[model samples]
Target: MCCLISAGGLNLIQLQKWNQAAVAKLCWDLAHKEDKLWIKWIHTYYIKDQQLGDCVIPQQASWMTKKILASRYIMLQSYLPSPQHQSMIRTFYLQLIGDLPRVQWKCLKFGNKARPKACFVMWLCLQQRLLTADRLLKWDIEASPTCVMCQQDPESHEHLFVTCTVAKTLWAKVLRWSNNQLCIATTWNEFVQWGISSAKGKAQQAQLFKMVFAECTYALWTERNQRLFESTSRHVDQLAKDLAVICTVRVPPGLQTLIHSFQF
Candidate 1:
């Protein structure tokens, strides 16, 4: 039988020598009959080149063979689970399934006037990964299921961030103070969509709106944590003033003039 020396200097035997019955027996011996479909799939897609002379190994990959080899190459490259490999799989899955809805990811996390920590917290809130009381309860952590800000509704991403009386009141004061006529949203997703759609016109206005929105989200969360851990609470008006102060400190010089115009 002919043998080819590959680039790695390994003598490779051609496909003709593979014992089909031995492979089938190996598959059967490894698992039950119900689990052998994968073995069948591998055999079906991995057909050997019948045109090649017996025992003659192919020396190089052609365009037709590149994809076939690349798939196996990628699987071999990541023997252990890792962030890079997980990201590659996530990208592949997203490409296969197509894009999600616009409202699913409308929150801006970067390129705005919000503080970096505030942006990150707001981003997590948008992603529904923020440790809201509901999320904590779901994780079996010790937390009250009721909203800390309002104490009138079940605590959740939506209720705490948008629909709570405290949140709604704070938003009303903020919108009126900023000279924005946009409507308040009742859910986290809708809030994100509103934040994206309401800030129209010049880039400066949009950026200032985002900065204010992020600061509000961050301040609300911090206030909630303070209430939870320190047994302290701030009134809705006070929380709104805190949010305004944060926005004033973070806004650009161009926006500082308008921010100065608003009374806290």
Candidate 2:
């Protein structure tokens, strides 16, 4: 069973079927020794009353075996075993639906879900896997944990994504380029809510904003990694230009034509 799970190749449906079979095997082992007793009782009660002869005994016994097998199947299902497998199932569902405020509009292109990378980062934030800039820099055993971007005390998902100066700059550029009005959000929850509720015209500009948001997020993480691992720094213009190049590559042909018309 461990080997099957550790193979890392089977999909969810395959894993579920494998677990069901395992459970059934365990149930059958527990009940196998009682098979004779069950057959005896069936013979004494079901066959004698019905006046069935010896030939019918085999048929009746086969029927009883099937009944007992089904009963064991149900028992196995109800056992509440495999907690680790259950947790994996739940995590899969959570990632599929996403969390908090719900940015379904932006995720529509991904088959009504966020991109895998975006979903993974969001899950990490939900699980509190990220550390503050000071901790990242000082290897600080302890600190107020302010964000590197804004340096306002105590970093968190909200601060890093929406409230930081770097994030604000990115948002401003998006608004300016798309020629749209946007309300700044101070918290992660609020940003997600705004993403869901904000007016998104079915036009090139609206589509551009979607690309901009995804590209900026990818670029921001790239910059963060560079700073952490390579001891390198980047100007905001450079980051934005990188993001623009990525967005240009991903934009639909119609939108790409519009973007190309710009002097920048």
Candidate 3:
């Protein structure tokens, strides 16, 4: 292959940083997949046993070819894949995508057994980026400047998710059902601080707290949409009952006791 030597991205690979090393190993294996005819052609005509990560791209290489080879940014020099652990690839992938600042609610976000849709809403709630009325009005959209849940204050993330009468009632019911002491506190910021301080435990109640938190956000947001767009609404009690069924279905058997005991 016509190529130039690399500029020393090669370094000793560490098991701790397997995300980089694994990519290098996969690039090393590009020529070995015998089932693919096109890949074999590329291997024979373009690569020809040249070190894949550090080699220069041919001027005639297609844009797609150059793009494909750009995996070298993550590839460690001289790294080779091992059969030592089957989970290494998955571990590497999680590490690759999870390179974010660690937060306490991460377990609630990912490890809590909430539904995917609920978790997505919970993410938006955490970022306070939900399209509440205040945000819509700021964007010059013709939206009510009052809270939909209470109609007493501007509908912002803090009011809608935290202090509104509807939200306070729903979270009180949900938290009380979980038999958590946290039911005493009412506010989104308080709950967020609670997640930061207490949600780190792996206990069943802790998991239940996280699951119901996300579930309640999903329910409240759905209720808000129903009132705003559909011009239909359910009572907060009905929302609680719906969440009871949902929590019963979403939670594990041990946590069902909590959901089953949801009285209001």
Candidate 4:
């Protein structure tokens, strides 16, 4: 019996269909209904009433196994769980669902580290959802694909945010003011890597860097959109000064010492 249970565990891990063979398979529509699916899984896997002398141990109902089942059911419904059970299940389901997409962004840790609105735009930029002119042209939108900010090279995630002449000016100014001689990165990923490395070790500086980086990206993207849609823009010097002021205002009170470093 122990060997059979071990085999069953291995089969489940391997995603084998052996468990379904233990009982008659239910139809799809009925299987998806939430009210009694738990009961069905229990009966199919643990209650072999049809076979004489077969007894499944109730002790095998482990928390991990139950969590997997609960996650499946909870995700299928849009409505929240009842008030009484909300607190108990909230953290489990949230962590379970939240962890799903994080694997895709393991290399990008800048999200959720700064102001929400700015972080939101930066997140969208990381996901390549900005719909810049270059992207629009790829979708056959029949628009000029040149960088709206520089109006020189074809616009892209890298060019508009990093390599554009205007953008390069902003970064150069910021780096100079901070007394750092590091050159501005040419690509978005490289920029993120540089920011992470530059601010490593000190927690306050790391958070400050994240906020400033996110704000800069947000300002740049907003400037791009306004250029595209509103036909207005800021000069590189004014934009850089605005970035410094924005960063100064957003800096935490405890980290006020470094706030002057951002001001021109």
C-alpha local distance difference test of each model? 0.62, 0.51, 0.68, 0.59
lDDT of 3 by residue, 51-144 (tens): 7655687778877566556655553423334646545454444434444344445666646678878877887787777898888888999988
- Least accurate stretch of 10 residues (summed lDDT) in model 1? 1-10
Looking at model 2, the pairs that clash are none
**Best model per lDDT:** 3
Ranking by TM-score: 3, 4, 1, 2
Q: Which residue pairs in model 3 clash with each other?
A: none
> Which window of 10 residues has the lowest lDDT sum in candidate 2?
1-10
Off by over 4 Å in 2: 1-14, 17-144, 198-204, 261-264
lDDT of 2 by residue, 107-152 (tens): 3122212244643444344333556454455674654465555545
Backbone clash pairs in model 2 (N, Cα, C under 3 Å; residues 3+ apart or in different chains), count: 0
Q: Residue 245 in candidate 4 has what lDDT?
A: 76
Which numbered prediction scores highest in TM-score against the true structure?
3
Clashing pairs in 4: none
* TM-scores of the models, in the order given: 0.58, 0.51, 0.70, 0.60
